[model samples]
Target: MGLVIPFDDKASDPGLEALVALVAADMNRVNQTILARTGSDVAMIPEVATHLISSGGKRLRPMLTLATAALCGYQGEGHVKLAAAVEFMHTATLLHDDVVDQSEMRRGKLAARLLWGNEASVLVGDFLLGQAFRMMVEVGSLACLDVLSVAATVIAEGEVMQLSAAKDTETTEDAYLAVIRGKTAELFAAAAEVGPIVANRPKAEVAACRAYGMNLGVAFQLIDDALDYGGQAAKLGKNVGDDFREGKITLPVVLSFRRGNETERAFWKRVLEKGDIAEGDLETALATMKKHRALEDTVERARHYGSMARDALELFPDSAPRRALLEAVDFCIGRAH
Candidate 1:
């Protein structure tokens, strides 16, 4: 067996806990596959990978793979390997993202790049990508490969778009959403869709899972952006003002900048566009966002997407997995509050 993350018995969300319990055995095998596949003879490869992998994360993406497969009545063992592949893909993205953002902390610890250097982090990320593909190939599902490979391409495109858009105050809300759809939602959609695809579910159900994951992923990223400014540091796993400091153009900043007065606009341009941030600028930015209800509005938009996610599952009959998936949308939105 692989390294198992101990589940907290005292889950506050009943639905989330139930979903975890429902897939407990499958997740165990998925964990084993993750640990097995991530190993490498290269000393630094496993070191950097383990540093990030062992760090605490909810492992929700892989869980989505497993849960969606079970939801479609899959009895095959292929889901275990596919679930691990999904996790590797997610972890690879995180490693690459930390490097791109020059982020210091990840999952409440020093980033892999910080400990292992950017060169090592990037190479290790490549290694993980290789492993993810290998696992996908081993599962031998053309549908799975198509979904995941396309997602890999979309995620790269999104990263490039985000790099180009960074510190560019003129980036529009629509453009921002586009970037996140590629960067975040594409993988989520692929993960869920692959589950049903491998399970041999109907085209309609597969499409529904894709829609659910796509909307849910958008909602998840929106909440993450909101939490960057409004959430507690302990709960958020990163500093509250990391986005502001990085000059990342997120939805809240777009709304605030578009609605602000001349002085406020100058403030945003100075800090975000020109990277001339002052000591108290984060406080000023927060105050401006609050005045414009930018954070609140962002969460409201997440709720809209969350609603879409919930509605996508209406095609599936009510079950523990269905209810849990519905509540998962609420869980995504609840992070900002």
Candidate 2:
């Protein structure tokens, strides 16, 4: 379906292999169909779209869309259209985010802003967003349209909150959770929630799938935050210091700040507030994390929600797809990038 991205290296986890295969096959099919529909008049739009869409993302959002559809008893292919819409919305946000952050790079390549300038990036992002809304209308489900519209709003709100909250070291854990829910988890929730909505399933089932996506998204972001310093910069593709340099407060930083003593607190205040974070500050931050067992605590929280996600999937039939969906919880929690 696409290049294999092993979520975990442990040889014993065959379930992860199965999950990755299914998710990748389903996601690639959606991507191909969606890009082709962009048409010739928007040639430059598709060109820049190709740069971001073909840049080798794992397509977790689309997978969630498909999995939720299957879990909710959808036997048709409409899930593919919805999944593609979910991905388009996600990619549009990424384009806008890079511009807003003035980021020169993403996934180790020149960002759309860096390669094509802000006007192109912003316009292309708008095109993708409009395309997604058009796809939702084509689905001919008012419920699906409603879910996506709300999700789009939530994603935008999260981005705004993140921009405002990043500079404050006093950023509380609750605030961090809210920002991620808006930026990352809201789409995950919407992607999954739309599945049942499209299928016209009972409300409780839709609620369960939505819960699964929400918890899974939070867990996924938590691990991603942990990997900022705990993971290899080469493996993550983006620079390791990006979060610190951008002053983005994430789970690891929240936990570290919670446990910081006198000097560590001062370090956070100066670096984040003054925007003068130094090379040595990174080591100091890492040490603070180690001393307070912040990483371990955050990992535990991720797993707890991962467990909730698996539990939510129990409403599904005991099929191969269901098993694959269940395994995704663990994969999302442990992924390095």
Candidate 3:
């Protein structure tokens, strides 16, 4: 459903064309290398990996890594390895995510779990995780190893936390944000920071870039959650209400609970705690959100993070990549699907 972003009125928005163009260039090159690496494996292990990798995705993480490298004036071959490494980590999590969520769809296609069975997907996901570490080692940087390893640990920790909090009304914005950082933003931070790490760039520049990526990553996920219900089913590539169907509580739902009245909340409790929602339960939940304006408020929060992300990049000198990175901040919020 997410693939069909609203672009017909592109002219209504200013400054988006250039950023999308630059980001697309980086993604195209990354995609080629990714296809080759995932395809070159001589066995089914590589073949399944290739199938999943070749399945369409936005490739946002790798693009962020490579773009930050270019912005930092990195002129090394190591950036490709770094980009691929970021992708491997992302794909690994995705493979596991589908199994955990018991999801059957991703990127508008049957999920790996559906195609190959959960066991195969789990083992292959492990392969990708191992492959990611291997790629990190190939870069030959202990610091990169430290950064990615720490991010991986935090990601697992966050996933556990989210699992514990999945349908509980007790989950807070603080807990939600923590889970989000671990699940989504930490890698963004690492991806952008790895550029400076590989380039041997200044420490302060590296730190700032990391901050930019982290904030943007958080904002990106926050907006992604909002889009789950608000986005067109075609744009989302899944059922419009999958998150609620899975009993996954997102920021919007979290905030809606906070904002809801007793009667409204009982509806949530029925759907969430009791898991007895009727067919139109999602529409009811969405109405509550609209009534509370939770979606608008969430979008505002995402924009605030995007602003911070762009400001973090101010420490670096201007370049096309830098400009593109800055524009991505706006795209994260302005997009509709």
Candidate 4:
């Protein structure tokens, strides 16, 4: 039998709820900005954009922008615009990612690329990215603009890096970490850092927010890597073993491949490197991963980063925002259970 990690009821969890409630008002404004900016005379732009935007993603990146801004004592509407921009950037990336991965589902629904075609999905992603930059320009903070723009560049680079390394069982942990840092964590770091930048908080506070976001983003991706093998489809919003099917070299795969014996390594090369997956291949992958404790160790790595994320916030005094942020870390790691 495959390893079965017990699932928790996410709806009853107060950790994310507290973060949501804390950012509710600003998030409303951010939502309005998103709606307003998504409109265009070209009908397909709205069609494709709204398909993914309306999908039930938690909008965690934008929430980070709002939460960290508030935590830094920001008292203005700029963060709302910045937050919306962050969401647009994230949504744009998802559209592009779906096309790149040839993914069928996203956020529990058909991927925009699948429904609208890859061309439309890619174009709409570009439209959203253009809108994101427009919103960033409107915010009139050169520093914030620079942070997000650089993140956009870094994300594209990361995607290319991952693509080059895809299906290669020889992928190292350091290379994997570099890919995730560029593809995922850079935006998180920018999102959090902008909050302090807009709030005119001290440089130290800005660095703290950036550190917290960077570490949290790493933990978030690691948990997701583990979940692709262990988590249920309903909670994951995608099929279990999607990464394996796609031949993606996530952390769990990296660890398992590195730890496997000669025959086990040959199995990995056939399945992942050659994409010769057959019936029961996923089960074998999971059983091999379990034998090596790959999933367990991947979650352990996530917890290490989660600890760093929480410690990053130690520079701040205790407050509702701080506590909420801490709980957010737990919420992320708890998904593995």
lDDT leader? 4
lDDT per residue (tens digit) for residues 281-334 in model 3: 888888898888777777778878888998998897788988888777777767
Write the number of the candidate with greater TM-score, choosing between 1 and 4.
4
Candidate 3: misplaced stretches above 4 Å? 1-29, 39-42
**Can you write out model 2's per-residue Cα lDDT over 1-337, one digit (the tens) per residue?**
0112223334233336655676676777797877775554867888888898888777878887887776677877778888888988989998999988887777778898888899999999999899888888888888888988999998889999998887788888899889988899889888889888877899988998899889888888887777776777666767775777777778878888778888887887787778787667877777788788776677677778888888887877788767877777867765643
Once fitted onto the true fold, the runs of candidate 1 whose alpha carbons sit more than 4 angstroms away are 1-15
Show the colliding residue pairs in model 4. Answer: none
Q: How displaced is residue 112 in candidate 4, in Å?
A: 0.9
Cα error, residue 99 of model 4, in Å, equals 0.7
CA lDDT of each candidate?
A: 0.87, 0.80, 0.81, 0.90
RMSD (Å) per prediction? 5.4, 4.0, 3.0, 2.2
Show the lowest summed lDDT stretch of 10 residues, model 4: 6-15
List of clashing residue pairs for candidate 3: 1-235, 1-236, 1-237, 1-238, 2-235, 2-236, 2-237
- Name the lDDT value of residue 70 in candidate 1: 82
lDDT (Cα, 0-100) at 248 in candidate 4: 98
TM-scores of all candidate predictions against the true structure: 0.95, 0.91, 0.92, 0.97
- Best candidate, TM-score: 4
Tens digits of per-residue lDDT for model 1, 1-337: 1111122223243336766777789898988887888788888988899888888788888888888998898989888888888889999999999999999999889899999899999999999999999989999999899999999999999999999999988889999999999999998898889889999999999999999999999999998888888777777777778999999999999999999999999999999999999888988998898899888788889889999999999999988888778777877776654
Compared with the true structure, model 2 gives a TM-score of 0.91
